[model samples]
Target chain A: MAYIKLDREKCKGCMLCISVCPKGQLKEDKGLNKKGIRPVRFLDKDCSGCAFCAIICPDCCIEVYK
Target chain B: MKKIFGRTRSLRGVDTHYCQGCGHGVVHRLIAEVIDELNIREITIGVTPVGCAVVAYDYWDFDCVESAHGRGLAVATAIKRLQPDKIVFTYQGDGDLAAIGTAETIHAANRGENLTVVFINNTVYGMTGGQMAPTTLIGQKTATSPLGRNEKTEGYPLRISELLAQLQGVYSVERSSTDSVQGILKTKNAIKAAFKNQMENKGFSLVEVLSACPTYWVLSPVESLDWIKNTMSKVFPPGRIK
Candidate 1:
């Protein structure tokens, strides 16, 4: 099993991670974060453990585990 | 589950002030990761430039010095010489390295300063509100070049990696980008190589990273990355130059 945790407060909502995720597990959340930006949420589906999203996250908000 | 990725200890547990989708944050993380992996955080010193990443020291947990605009290499050279056992590096932007500090960078490389230089070439001066930098592509529009950069007037984009590679004192030179997953990985590896070269007593290593400036470019973060891939890479191709 693969899992990724996101620090929503640190997320800038750039969505770069969403674009790079091979598993399409991330999506933009409708709720605003502390910074008043829409944060991304993981779909909690079958993650491939590629870690592409974590790698591309400029804010360093994501941590990946496999 | 095994932890595959997390923030490195070399970086402070604080969020960076970089704008949304900025490449500086990604580059910072990569450097921090490299420092942790190499176990050199305690002996590493970073020189921060006067551009967008001017306050890079605030995010990095290691010792850092602030340099005057474009004088990053000069300060870094002094630091490396005085403390030969330390791993010194300069994090400079396109405007700081290729324009105001060009002479310092060239002289440092020519003298083989035995330091690492992480050059962020984002085409425009991102911090000062999108001014045309020395690396700005021809026909690209910036605040200073509102009418678009003309070849006859602007001359051409300065390819710093290629120019520095020509110096005999330079040990290694590589150009990488932050446009894609592979490109980001390559950039991290290039940074690691530069740091390793310094540790191995190899003289002057420069890794020029073609980064994105979404706010300055008047494009979305993703679009700016695409521009770097499809447009900027054509002029500053990613690869080893020396």
Candidate 2:
């Protein structure tokens, strides 16, 4: 299992991470950040710690742990 | 649990000024990661350009100097020459490097300055409201060229990496993109290699990154990446030029 922490305040809700995550581990959260953007949340159970989300994220808001 | 991916210590924890889906933030993170990995943050001197990344010094926790419009290469050259041991790099955008700073960049590379240049080619003058840039593709539409860039008047997109590769003083040149996971990884490696070449005192090294300007392109974040892979890469393919 992999753990991903998102710095919601730092996120701009670009959604680029969603397209890159192989595990479908990230999705848009209903709540909005201070910037009025819907930040992403970790959602899947079968994460493989691929850091693709971190690499593709323009905001550097996601941190993955294994 | 061990941390697998986290923000590099070289980068400030604050949010960047870049717009959503802008590639500047990713490029900045990659450069910060490279600087941290090489343990050269203390000795590295970055020259920030006058385009969208004009305030790049605020994000990277290192010594940075702001250069005038299109003068980043000239400033970086002076810094590298004065302190030969210090690591010097320039962060420039398409409008800054491929347009106004063309002469400075070419001459510096031709002189073989032991420096690294991270050029962001987003195909438009992003900070100046999406004006057509020298790197703008012939058929791409911009604020200045609403009917698409006309070949007769705009000439052609400036292939800076290929152009710099032909110069004898340049030791390494690569064109990469930040549009996908694989492209981002390749871009990171290219930037690292550019820095390594400078560390080895191997003349001039440049990594031209095809970045996205979603705000100007008027595309969603995902569409911009798709355009980069499907459209942009056709005009400027990703690969090593030198």
Candidate 3:
């Protein structure tokens, strides 16, 4: 199974990853991090490992592995 | 199964100071990825600008020299001239490159300096609170231009890529955006090409990247990307200008 990890603290909660993920594998977290920003979370296990989120992320907060 | 994506060692283990959806962070990762792929971490040097990314040296894990506002090219020129073997590049913004450092940039390009320049064109002075920049589009409202930029007073958005391409000293000049997945990949390729051109001693090369400023643009992070794609791209089309 492919796995995508998001570094929550490093994320600026931009949601750019959510918009770019073709599989819709990521979603915004309801709770805020220490920075008081709503970080994103991996939504499902059906990840394509496309690395699109990693690429488009402005904060370098996502990691995709297979 | 193989690892597809992760952080590059060329970048430090620290969060960037850029705002959410800021293009500097994305570009920083691309540069770090390129440095890792090229195996030039040991011999690469980056010159920092005085804008939003002024502290870029702190994020990048390579030797970085801080340059005065708009003097990135000048500093990179000196560094490259002295350490002819090192891969020298400059990370600059529109305000630093197109405004304050225009003379230095033009002269460095004309001199055929062997170095790479990653110019982030967000169309406004981001760090200084969204003041109008040399690349700000017409009718674009900025901190200084509250009613939007007037052609009669502000003239037109400066097309640095096209102007630099006309220089005989420049070997490569490309304009790319970071609005979409395809655009980001293209931008990475363009950045890699710029660095590769410098490595081959192919004279001056620059990649003008049309990035987003969501906070200053008064738009959401996602909306900024759309602006880059639909609005920004029209004024500054993405492609190999040279």
Candidate 4:
């Protein structure tokens, strides 16, 4: 069940992490993050446990439970 | 349970020839891990440059070729274009990449050749008696710059990643460091991405790894890591440059 997360406060919601997910499991939640950018939302159920989502993330805002 | 030692038989245990606190070993291991994980041991061809990583052929157990200082990328480009079926990658140091091979690196990237560049930027030239490298930071002391690199005279350090990323032919370009555990892991992933992109026929890929040079930099291994973490990160930051 170990997968991924984007801390709401830390997530800049740049959409880069969502765009780079090889599995297309991440989505944008037009809702604002702490900085008011569209926060990156995750489809935890579809996560393949691949860390590409975490690696391409520029801000190091990704946390993979695995 | 974690696997012990290297995952690729391509890298036989010869006890690395690299000096302590040198990032070459870690970089080498990252390449090995990628080759093993991708199951491309026989297909991978590595081109070594004339620097600390020159003897990479001796350690990495794959098809290897040695090239002159700063000419590794040129050599790898030729090999890759001729043998596009093979996975071609060049392992180069800062002196080999930024200084002597500037034209080769820029043109190769501009051409979008299907090859991978594993650039180890240690700031100062390590093999050539610690000479001032193109990436040497201002106010940083080297053998050639006893009074530190005077930006007024020597000019500022060249940011290779930022420059290379601007080229249209490049498939991807990124920078990572080996100073910390997480950073080192990220460095491996970056190199893996470069190689993977090449395998997927994406075009030219370059992964600039900010490494520590204890012998050349005249700093203790621990101090060098600290310097890489605090000093180098300030200028390059981390993650994708492209």
**Candidate 2 steric clashes:** 0
Kindly list the per-residue Cα lDDT of model 2 for residues B105-131, writing each as its tens digit: 999999999999999999999998999
**Which window of ten consecutive residues has the lowest lDDT sum in model 2 chain B?**
B154-163
- Can you tell me the DockQ of model 2? 0.92
Docking class of 4: incorrect
Docking quality (DockQ) for each candidate: 0.91, 0.92, 0.86, 0.02
Q: How much is the lDDT of residue B142 in candidate 4?
A: 89
Model 4 agreement with the true structure over B1-242: per-residue lDDT tens digits: 22222135666555554554577766886788788888999899999999888888988888999998788888998898799899999999989999999999999999999999999999988887899998999999989999999999999999988998999998899999977667878988898888889889999999999988888888765677789889988987778878
Per-prediction interface RMSD in Å: 0.6, 0.6, 1.0, 13.5
User: What clash pairs does model 3 have?
Assistant: none
TM-score of chain B of each: 0.98, 0.99, 0.99, 0.96
Native contacts retained by candidate 2: 0.95
Two-way DockQ contest, 1 vs 2, winner = 2
Across B82-199, the per-residue lDDT of candidate 1 in tens digits comes to: 8999999999999999999999999999999999999999999988899998898999999999999998988899998899999999999999999999999999999999999999
Estimate TM-scores for all models.
Answer: 0.99, 0.98, 0.98, 0.77
How would the candidate models be sorted by DockQ, starting from the highest?
A: 2, 1, 3, 4
Weakest ten-residue segment in model 4 chain B by summed lDDT:
B1-10
Worst 10 residues of 2 chain A by lDDT: A37-46
TM-score of 1: 0.99
After superposition, the stretches of candidate 4 with alpha carbons farther than 4 Å from their true spots are A1-66, B1-7
